[model samples]
Target: MKKIIYTMILAAGVFSTTACVDELDQTPHTEITSGDVYTSAANYKSVLAKVYASYVIAGQEKGGGNKDIATTSGYDYMRCYFNMQECGTDEMASTWLEGDKVKDISYLTWDASDPWVSDTYYLIYQTIDYANEFLRNATDDNISKFSDSDRALIKQYRAEARFLRALSYYHAMDLYRNIPFVTEKDEVGSFTPPRYTSSQIFDYIESELKDIDGDLLDRSEAEYGRATKGAAWTLLAKMYLNAEIYTGKARYSDCITYCNKVIGDGYSLEGDYSKLFNADNQKRTNEIIFPLSVDATHTVSWGATTYIVCGEVDGNSSENPLTYGVKSAWSMFRLRGELTSLFASGDKRAMFYTKGQSQYLDTGIDTQTNGYLMTKYRNLLDNDSVASNTASYGASIDFPMFRLADVYLMYAESVVRGGDGGSIGTALGYINKLRERAYGSTDGDVKTTDLTKNFILDERARELYMEGTRRTDLIRYGKFTTSDYLWQWKGGVKDGKAVNSKYNYYPIPQTELTANPNLHNDNY
Candidate 1:
């Protein structure tokens, strides 16, 4: 699947957007028209390939200048998502101020004009538009033209496309509460997309997942990196877990219902947590439900796992890039001083490289040596410490977007939040599985009485740091903009003060408002 992404010829032209020009800048792949590209059934698969490939590659060439969604310098889809999700929380700190919204994201000072935020907005919409184009082309009449086996397969492909679009909408709803929502039903040329309330977006996402259930392949049967029953179940479970926040309705019971589906199926914890982030992540397919598949030979975007691997490296140890299986050391982002205490005694998950770095960001994010560095992610093969070719290209490491570990955490959290049909004992057993893997023993296990919402939150920080869940977790727990929780440099202040409640909902990009008359700031 990783090599197939490069083997297929990228579609020359994709569906163009009709939304206000300021909100969308979707450049065509070539002079070729969407009609010419989707005429043949073989091209149907290729267009679908474009949908999945959009997550890993920025443009035609590997990290080349001919780009798709241009915004910031290193504006990879997940890379900017990481900035929005982690940098302002206690889990991560960034020193990068060069890009559009690098500083704003790290300090929680982002506004409508912030370039990176705007780019990220366009990128998410671009992804949805790609999926929409695929769905529109791969229709029932189109499927009828194919062989029986091909017809069955094409149906599955449509389900995967819907799931991907729903995933993007979930991200949009998470980052920016109220947003413009569109689907394949909405044609390419648009005057103004009706602004969707947070609940409207949530209902659309939930129904989309449920509608595609029969068409999705079973998790065990689906190929790696493609959406399957487990992926859909996991995503639905996640939205349900956050139902109160998204829709003002408690859906913990539904969260548990779907979580049981994933649990009853086959996913489990990988024996080693380190292998989950390493280059040979494909081997951990039993645990990782969906990933943005990447390798050094192809999909060389600096925005995904490459940024994750290189960004963690301290430039002072420039000689150690190969040690982490990449050629360059960004050393731009690091663990917050507050995170140092999360790793208690004997937690093997602690992979800090503090020899020449400070445990705390004493002088703040500017100085490279101000904060401790991490060895959590390595771009080399799991078995081989020394990998070749990775030094010249970017990282070969794949980022696990959703995995069994997250499912386990979600189940435990739902149970704690008054979700029914899941026993506290079962939740304990699931969490202990992660603890045993992290500590290599049962010594770190906790009793049923020890399982609380606070424990679940900290456990998530300890386990899911840098995987892009921190900011959302903080918001869900009522600690993001309130005085309830404070970390270093939050709200652009070194001491970490409570920001305005408006930070809860990031302002709509001013560009979006000016271009689309239907858009308003009343929600923000």
Candidate 2:
């Protein structure tokens, strides 16, 4: 599969050389067009491959030359999204001080000009534009040059492109609430699409997913790092789980409906919780429904798991960098005290290093030893091996975006939230499966009477920490901005403080508002 992704890299270079243009310009560059590139079935698949590559590759060419979005840095999509989603919450924090506006995220003092906020906005739309460009060019009339089997393959490509577009729109709807909506139907010259309310975007995403559900490959057939019926079901379950937050309407029954679809799809929990984050997680496809594939050799980048694995190390630790499959340590990201406390004495999920670090953070001296180090995500393989080509800037570990365990947690939460058509017993069974895995036995299993909304929140933290989900989970639980749930160093204080509720949704980037008059920052 790495060979295939490398082929797509060459394809991406050809596609971008011909049809790429500045996203903010709103007009296609007259230099070259899609007609010059979409000449055959292989070319059409290449173009579709570039749409998926947009999430993994940060630029036109690999290793930081021609970036998709130009911000303070190259601003890779996953790295920026992880910073925005995890840094400001109880799960993680950074120690780097030079040019680090990430502290603003931890402090809840961000405005529209924050580079991460703007980069996330740009990255989502950039990926959407790529998908739309593919959809517009890969029409049935345009693809008549191919055979019937080739045409059928192109149909699946079109559905995958639509699914990718909906995924980006789902992120936009989650983060920015009201966003400027565009699609393949929209003209590409000097146009500014009007803003759609959160509910409208929600409805659009749901309809788009349903329209493409049957066209997508099943879980068993989906290639590595590609969308499938399970991916669509998991995403729909997530959106429906947060329906109350997005549309002011409770839809937990709908959440349970999609969750059950995924749960019944033959996906089961991985026996060893830690093996799912190792370098060879590609083999753990039984549990991981969707993943962002990374490689030390072929798919090398400063983003992806390279950023995650190196960021959590200490500068002076006795641990071997080669053990984690990196050349050097970054000594940056660490856990807050609130996170380590969520685990019990013998929970196997409590994979934290507390040798020289304090559980309680001292904000006055925010050093590497201020908080416990999280060892959840490592660069070793399942057999305790590192990649042969491991370097300081790349890792082979793949990041799981959606897995079956998360679906189990979502199902339990929906049932506890008063969603109908779901049994509490089934929800309890789902949760105890995760617990049994974490504890390596049934000793940590919870009784049916122990199920509650609060218990699910803490259980999610214990199960899914450092996987780029804590901030959104906290927001959904109504504990993100309020002082009701405070963590060490939150809002830049030793004892956490409440921040303005406007931080709930990041402000629409001021550059976007200045560029398009049709868009406004109504929520903030």
Candidate 3:
């Protein structure tokens, strides 16, 4: 099926996708004023699609000529967040020299001035700003002009806007701890957003998710890219799973509750695990609960799956770009050596190209040979076909924001932590289901005796590495900044020494602090 995303190019009045072409595509609208943009029912959905697309593409252009963030187009929301989650963790490393912020993150020596640090902070708010703008116009008066059917759809869309806002604030709260926040309720002017305590932000996220519970579409009914009840539940489960870190209380039972809710939704594991990350993954709706849609021919950005697939290829090596469905090889990133030890033979989770890489990395990861490259997130289709996507023209592989396999893993982790409302037997069944697919048999199944915290963490590493969950997982287990688990060059030390706990949460970017006197980061 051909993907459909409405393009609305508004310099100041809207947030939108940069590209959409051909039939079923409406002519791109421009300079939509805030008051008149919501005059029609179709425009409401079109702008809502913009809120979703803004995260993937940079701005209202085919590719990179215009961008939301002037410093770097690649620092769009998901890419910046991906850098925060994967680079410094044991899961990944960079081949670039130590002159850039990407390298700064790989070494965990990032300061507030780091481009990624600032971009992650800003792009998240940009997303929230767009969501708030949508919510602001989605009032009862605005929709009262439309038909009853359109009114109903707008109500659902309003709730989805709130879900997207909560999603952005969730990232902000996790990475920055305490920061200023804004909402549709606040005045949209040049005033500073008031700083909320981390707990206040946590409560706000929880409240928003709960409030939208009845308003969101059921998992099976919503469009593939839109937020659904399952997506909100998954976010709640993930947030609750880390409740102690966020709010000083263990909410594992709550995590279990939401995970169970998602489990009961009409999602199931994709029979082939690798197919979940392939270019044709949009058709694999069996597992992808919420997706960031990308079109090889239309939506184009040097981010998301394109960033992952292209960067994994070494142009110097015989790694053909066409095999990965991209036009170029960046030769930038590979799996860190520590992750290499996690997989044993026959574990299909080990998607490494190890022929030319060292089994272990040396002190510096400044060369292509430092660690084994990952062949996991490819642009190859489920049928082994490649899309003709250029480096600027994004790949067709949609990024899964939430999936059933992750929900299953969250449920099992909650149960292992002695959370009530979950059954260990059921959790074990879920683990075996994942293991069956990973090993192509039941050979990798674990017994109840193996259901320790460490086992669960390692299992998550094998199942979800490089998909942007590593840093958070390591922090929850007290291994991210502690001496408990060490990877090479952690803390900028050759042998990986313990770093200050302040490194756990990034500093409030220097730019943010200079702009808002009301803001401060105690951890920094």
Candidate 4:
């Protein structure tokens, strides 16, 4: 049995892969190999740390202040925006296909040769490699040395690695229906693993999560903000919820099963909706399952805290001078007016957006023209960075990867899909629970009989804006290829208009394409 406190290095010394990319240029920092560093437990910890490094990096790029892909400016390249009539850049050429109403965003059009898609693929796969290394080297013998309590920790770590890998694959499958499924660390070979169908990929993820569910500690043993049984079940529940879209077969029953597991596992909604997004509430509440943990001192996690640009009166902005007064041109995403108006008069989510007639920028808020500015991650009035402009710019919100609310919603959806429980009744019970928490009201006499998929989709949209699941959810519901946002399809326009769906999947990188002739490119 493996000793829990000890570390073991794989006996294979100095395994390295030859690069097919520009060999003369300095190698990427990610390509660096283990140079006798795997000899101790601390080294193993570092490796584990490295596995999570990508979350911070990607989080910085996507969810950070840049708001690069979340805003109207980001969608300027797509042709879907009827009101905002122009493509912004060639880089966003693929976004035009988001809702499929029309084709072409920018006057310029390009194929899969775009670098953005390929770059993300590389980043995600690199993360998977880090996780694979841990899986390959973390031996049961080395892990058994610890007391049972510590052994659970090791198992948790292993499960965490697998979860990350599965997450990376889920991302890949979302963007590109076909991708090489790499489960282990091996040299890129002549034996190319053909792309698995999207259905197959989801199956793979569900199976992996299920296999480790028993090994995972019960919910009480799980620490807050870490991957736990709740997190795994939530992810599996979501995968099952979307099974019909991915595989053309509904797995609502399975979805409900996982959702029930998460609900029965003892997670409840945090009392305040605002608590879920504020930095001060991090790890203090049990509402969240798996969160990307960022510490003020330890991790250097700026997140969107410095990036989202809004004035102090908007309720989401801080009064700080440094980051407070600064204006960011890229308020890239805004909520659809249709979605914002769907809330009940007393709905708590209404506060998430600035409503009609509120001046945005310099213009009066025009309901017919202006959209609702999402305040989910905005800086608060009394933020840590309130005095310091640079420090107090945006809200230090922990990105919720999985949460109890989501589990409840997924369970409800599963009931609608025919789980053993009262389909509409089960779903309504959870939705009402979420509503109570969202409005900060006591759970009393809540009721609903409808459980439409479209309604659930809208609820998810309201709850999860700019949190990175937008694209996947949109695609699964058949809305991605057709949404007419201001910035459409990778900023490319066709026939003097923006084009959409030109590049659904990221193209295989030029470097990879050249290296492995066996690998084929997605229609770039």
Best by TM-score: 1
For model 3 the local lDDT of residue 224 reads 67
Candidate 2 per-residue lDDT over residues 332-370, each given as its tens digit: 688888888889977999988788788867753257787
Please rank every candidate by TM-score, starting with the best: 1, 3, 2, 4
Cα RMSD to the true fold for all candidates: 1.9, 2.7, 4.5, 8.2
Model 1 clash tally, residue pairs? 1
Best by lDDT: 3
Instruction: Give me the runs in candidate 2 sitting further than 4 Å from their true place.
Output: 1-6, 9-32, 388-393
Q: Which parts of model 3 are misplaced by more than 4 Å?
A: 1-6, 9-11, 15-31, 71-74
Q: Positional deviation of 84 in candidate 3, in angstroms?
A: 0.9
Alpha carbon lDDT at 466, candidate 3 = 86
TM-score, one value per model:
0.95, 0.94, 0.95, 0.72
Q: Rate the local accuracy (lDDT) of all candidates.
A: 0.80, 0.79, 0.81, 0.51
Q: How far out, in Å, is residue 396 in model 4? A: 3.5
Candidate 1: where is the Cα deviation over 4 Å? 1-7, 27-29, 70-74, 98-101, 385-391, 522-524
lDDT of 1 at 46: 70
Worst 10 residues of 1 by lDDT: 1-10
Q: What is the TM-score (0 to 1) of candidate 4?
A: 0.72
Candidate 4 worst ten-residue window by lDDT? 76-85
Per-residue lDDT value at 14 in model 3: 50
Cα displacement (angstroms), candidate 2, residue 204, comes to: 0.4
